[model samples]
Target: MQQLLDHVAALKGEFDREVFTDSYWAIRDEYDLGAADEQFWPPVFQRAGIESDPTLVASAAAKDAELASTIAREPHQLLLEIADAGVPLGILSNAPHRMAQSVRESDWASVFAHLVFSSEHGLMKPDRAIYDLAASHFSDVEPSTIHFFDDRERNIVGAHAAGWHGHLWRSVDQARFELRSLGILTKR
Candidate 1:
């Protein structure tokens, strides 16, 4: 788990260091910058390679749109299994409200008892306020009884600080094992 966390941390560092260079800003300017919204920036920055040109940004946006559509939905077997055991399930995600609503529109939302999105609360993960909000949902359950699963290490750390058991999510199998170890999920 420590090694997995280290790898994720390293990837985050690399992305932060390389993805938002001066060339990205230049490309943003070429796109008539302010005209394009925040949603366009990530793919533009990733694809443009810092040259800051309209063609690159356009190309990047097209590629990103294709990639987004191509994303395969993973089976929520573990989530369903956990929920079937009658354990209360909650989601605390940093995703935008639209994304959260989309998740609910999909089959995944049925698996959770509560879904807390950062954008709706004006707070994001790793911020104690968001965790506190999530914690509030499980009022009947002790803080230690509430287990949190997130892909981000910082969020997991925050969960721990907020007195909840935290699992650094990687695969569903790993997550299941962690939940079982914490006595939150029963073995089939």
Candidate 2:
């Protein structure tokens, strides 16, 4: 995200890092950036004073997009490890609907019971409604028992406030350590 923002910032003089960050989240909070996949971006770019198609602008930054899409092997292995131990898994991402498409294309689709994204519901994280919606996918599970891992402190705080066991993501080793503590990764 930072890389993509920097790419656009280089093209548009007015929207520096701070301006881009503010506008991006403000728009995501207002309309959910994934509401129309990449289409939700044109309005945002317009706010930043760039009228060219956001997709075209994004296409010009192919390298950043490519880097963004790469998934590490360790996370995949961790998912398989826990899944094989019968721990149900889910994903709550404040990303575009294209992320769901990527998950579908990869092995992650089967590992997770569901992928709840912001664009689909017109709500992003820090919004309790999105957390409630994610919880709904697991009918019998209590929200307090569902652990959410995110890199952002605000998102972790939001998920925790929403009654989930949200934790800041650091490393795969840390995750395995925590999951083991929860007894969710015990060997079968």
Backbone clash count for every predicted candidate, in the order shown: 2, 0
Write one digit per residue (lDDT tens) for candidate 2, span 99-163.
55555566555888888877678788888888899999999899988888998898888898889
For model 1, the stretches where C-alpha displacement exceeds 4 angstroms are 1-75
lDDT of 1 at 162: 90
Please report, in order, the local distance difference test score of every candidate based on alpha carbons: 0.62, 0.72
Each candidate structure's TM-score, on Cα atoms with residue i matched to residue i, is 0.64, 0.74
Q: What residue runs in model 2 are displaced by over 4 Å at the alpha carbon?
A: 1-69
- Which candidate leads in TM-score? 2
